[model samples]
Target: MSLKSFGAKIFAKNIRKKIDKWASKPEATQKKVFQELIDKAKDTKFGKDHDFKNIKSYADFSKKVPVRDYEELRFYVDKMVAGEEDVLWPGKPLYYAKTSGTTSGAKYIPLTKDSMPSHINAARNAILCYIAETGNAKFVDGKMIFLQGSPEMEEKNGVKLGRLSGIVAHYVPSYLQKNRMPSWETNCIDDWETKVDAIVEETRNENMSVISGIPSWVQMYFEKLQQKTGKKVGELFPNFDLFIYGGVNYEPYRSKFENLIGRKVDSIELYPASEGFFAFQDKQTEKGMLLQLDSGMFYEFIKADEFFDENPKRLTVGEVEMGVNYVMLVSSNAGLWAYNIGDTVQFTSTNPYRVMVSGRIKHFISAFGEHVIAKEVEEAMQEATAATKARISEFTVAPQITPKNEELPYHEWFIEFEKEPEDLAKFSKTLDESLQKQNSYYFDLIEGKILQPLKISRVPENGFQQYMKSIGKLGGQNKLPRLANDRKIAEVLEKIIKA
Candidate 1:
């Protein structure tokens, strides 16, 4: 075997052993250690540098820092782009991870070296958690494929360096780093299309075992692989063991993947962002488990009701209650003080600190002005799927303005189904009813005629993925955004919205 392959095998073994240790610990012990890290972080440069002087205790820390939203960060991004740095941070930002948001335009988030380690460690633990949960560590013996953004970085210092992907390459355990795609650093700046195309061609014949990245890209690549090989991907990559993903919800996309592969693929959830890697999927379940990187930052939470108010209270890691929805705030190595990324979370357990991502603060539709939150939408979606006996592949929801100028607006749904339902129209109506029952304001809006009838677009095939690729957004950080709040967004929706 080549040295790279040999090294990967060794690295995989070492990671598995390390994961066993992390997963074997009792929940209480893990929480104790995590809390100690949080205490130390409060005193670290990254922590003290934040508005923590006012935070005498974890409770105080939570109370002092107001839960902020992405718009607040965008205000800072605009300033940095304009050469203002006072509120942005102290050091030079390494590069911005372009995130697709509600509006078509992307948000360029600053990611510095300080912010990098959080994601690196979080990704590492997410894998470890998977191993401990499944008790299968030998699956990573072959080449692993990561379908992420290209490795090319813009030219700097008379030399082009791949930015984030390059950083990932450099930071991956030295042993396993050799197995990464796109060897040459100079090819980093090529747009995702050219890069993905090249990656598809290069890995066509390689024996890949582990695949990682967003579900959409993986789905697209597997489709291409089928077209080229004229056989199931398992025939080509028999050793492929794990399919890890994060950055978006995995529901609706899971069944399609299982059917294509002819077997269920174990998936690991990762919680990473331009700012930090906050959590990972636990070993016990495919569902996301919060990996508390206590050493890197001090955490705070504000109840959902308390998120936007000026005088809202915040909760610390110690003070958080189980199953209550709270917006997250972080003071990390990158110097973001009391920064809220608009993520809502719920505690799965208090001892080990496992949490689940609830939803985005801004990603919701309130056509009836009932102010439907993302969690509510998710719950309604789950209920609708269960009741209608419809297996949705992928979906997005947005509020529409009817000519009636009604109080509650119409909700438009874009969906792809796994199979044709026996009662397609009835299924759609049931979905609408489920949404209203889940949220009475949704029903009130319908009764008042503020919102028009719910429209559904069961796409022909591969419709959503095509839409994503057209915008140069294929993997992680690209979810069909809810509540197209911007005026221009209405124009884009007009083209995609169909009954």
Candidate 2:
């Protein structure tokens, strides 16, 4: 084995031992983290405002600090942006993660000194965990590439500001610094198309052992490489054996990726966000990512269904149950107190606290009270894809309240197929059946003839690409939702559907 590979294995063994220690006592570890956060921030402005010193338990904390989303917490964030010290955390934030928000044009999520390592270390450990489990560290010796935003940052009140991924780019671990690729100049290119072209030229003839990014953007990179050389990614980079991905679920794009690579690669799933690095897939055979219990962030969960309802029951690490959908809440060392992070999750393994991100709390369809979620639609499509041997490029769903034929309102699906199925009718039928099995309210609505069976609108090849380009989010970590509550995306897709 090469020296790099041997070192990776040794490093991985030590990290795995540490992960196992905390993962085994999740509740206790989380409790410790919770107390540490409270103790550390007790003297900050937010703590003083929330009566943190008087807070003794979860009940006291909840009563003092109400959960707030970005918009709701913008008042305090605005103060920090203007260079306030000891306002939220102990001191000024180290970085501001610039992300596009729902109503607010741009959101600046604070990343403090203590909280930044949670992001860096969790990502590093994920690879280490993979290396330890598979006993394959050869990938560490070859070129590894992550398709991410430019590392360029602008300063606001002496705090560096950029996209979360871009900020993360500045912190590439020392060991893998030599192995990481696509050069600084190419990565700094602002326009994604130009940058990707540069990447293809630079790495086409090189050994690319590991590729990591959001699936959609990575697919674009894969396509660009294939177009240039007319060879599958696996053929071009035979040493490519590992794929690390985050931002969106990969199951929907698994078939397309497999076709592009012409084979399977061991993969790791990560659940990282600007709020905190929450989880990472530690075992190749596991169903979910292992929750980071000792990471300087305390977690709270409320049932997604009860989220809109007043006084919803909140559960801590020990109270969460398996397979129940919960809207995640975080109180972290970054000084966010009982903050709503928007994503919903379902615990797959409660013993060690492994979870699957189910959907976004805001991105749901309850138009007719059917209350459908992204997980339901994605899984339904997965089932249909498997049953019909279809290769889906991309897809999204929205409720069609006014049918063209003036028929009963129903859910309309827009699907882009890499390879069209032999039987579109059978595919649609299977999709409806799978959705019905998963959502009782949707099933009831269809059974009572209140809503029609879901319809599929075929999007021509590269339709999603055109749509994203029009929206100025063609590449990078941007991801279109799997489902939406209304027809906004559908309306836009309608005009941009490939002719």
Candidate 3:
């Protein structure tokens, strides 16, 4: 390495040392420090008329503005594209993080200079907390890998919006940024599948010490890595010590990961989105992740039981009760106020503020007009698998609308099993019973003659993962979208759904 690169490493080490000191404090202390940081945000305003001074506390601040969504930001983004100043926040939006929504295509999320720090700091906290947990502050010294979209998201106008991963790299303290495989400048907007393959090839020979990305894509990339490198990932990237992931459920994916790497990865869960990074793994044993409430944002949780047109309820951070699900609404420095991110989560405990992300509200299957959620499916599948002695690696459920000739609509599951069962039909029946038992709505729909039996397709061991790879759409921020609820998704499912 060059002298500059070597010097950068030393600088990174010192920075990490400082972060370690900050994170070594008790969780309660960190929360207080973060709250103070948030208080400063309230005091910082753009114009003389900016009304934040009237807001005395987090509860008062949240009540002043109704919860918002991605659509609200899109309106501001439109203004930014039209050359409007201070459109997204109080200042110019310095970066637009392009991310896909459930529908209406890609949303160009505006990130002002003020808001980016929240994301950067939250990520810093994640790293430092991990170090504190493991007692290893020099974690970044090893080679790192991130399975991300191609750094080439050049738009039709020739202006390049850096890939989400590239933007992170650019903002990282220069000393800590890893020596990435493909130069970010060369292929910023390359398709997701292309990025996955390129990342696999780029890291084929290198010894990666840390790996990070969405679980679905990471699973795909590892599968491809094994195929192309002709060696298991444990052999190729022998030094890999940590695997950080978020943006998807790890339960459907955990086993496949263990088999590929030949060991249990030191997994860390993170909540990162185009808007901001929200939370991270809190404790080694619990299912909860801690939120960065004090990092440039104010947070609220909507109670799952509360309703406005039957929608979930919103609760302020202070009002949160342990073990109840709530939707997240955020007010960020990026100019978004009371934005509902559409994710559902529950606090496992509140003393240290531990939470578990349940799933997306709109991303569930209820084809027979019976509301069935992803978590319900996961639970039923787990119970059925345990009872029938079948192991499922990964699975997705699609609602198959009836053809013009068909009489009814039904649910189809694309499942990859650990081992082919001797009696697939019996296994299917057991799973159906499990689903009925756990999800009464699903059971009612199935038994009362609203829907038919759930169809099962035994997918080729890695078929879905490969399909995502073949299409150049796997890894990092991109994932295997569950609950293909629309017609476009239906058509895609038609081709993939087995008889």
lDDT per model vs. reference: 0.62, 0.91, 0.66
- By TM-score, how accurate is candidate 1? 0.78
Ranking by lDDT: 2, 3, 1
Candidate 3 lDDT over 81-176, as tens digits, reads: 566664445545677777766564777766677777877776666666665555554446666766665554454232246556667666656655
Q: Candidate 1's error at 367, in angstroms?
A: 2.5
**Leading candidate by TM-score:** 2
Worst 10 residues of 3 by lDDT: 41-50
Residues 1-499, candidate 1: write the lDDT tens digits. 5554444455556665654454445344335543444454455333454554454544565455444455655655665545444334454466665555554355656666556766676676666656555556665556777766555455432223333544565566765655555445423535555555666677778877788877766776777777777767777777776888876666656656766676776778777776577777765543447555443555777887666687777656767888888888876655455778778888887656777887876666644566666656556566666666666666666666644544445666667676655677777777777777867787787788666558775564666666666666555435566444333444443455441
Better of 1 and 2 by lDDT: 2
RMSD of each: 5.2, 0.9, 5.1
Instruction: Estimate TM-scores for all models.
Output: 0.78, 0.99, 0.80
lDDT score of residue 291 within candidate 1: 50
Residue 445 of model 1 has an lDDT of 76
TM-score-superior candidate, 1 or 3: 3
Q: After superposition, how far is residue 73 of candidate 1 from its true place, in Å?
A: 6.0
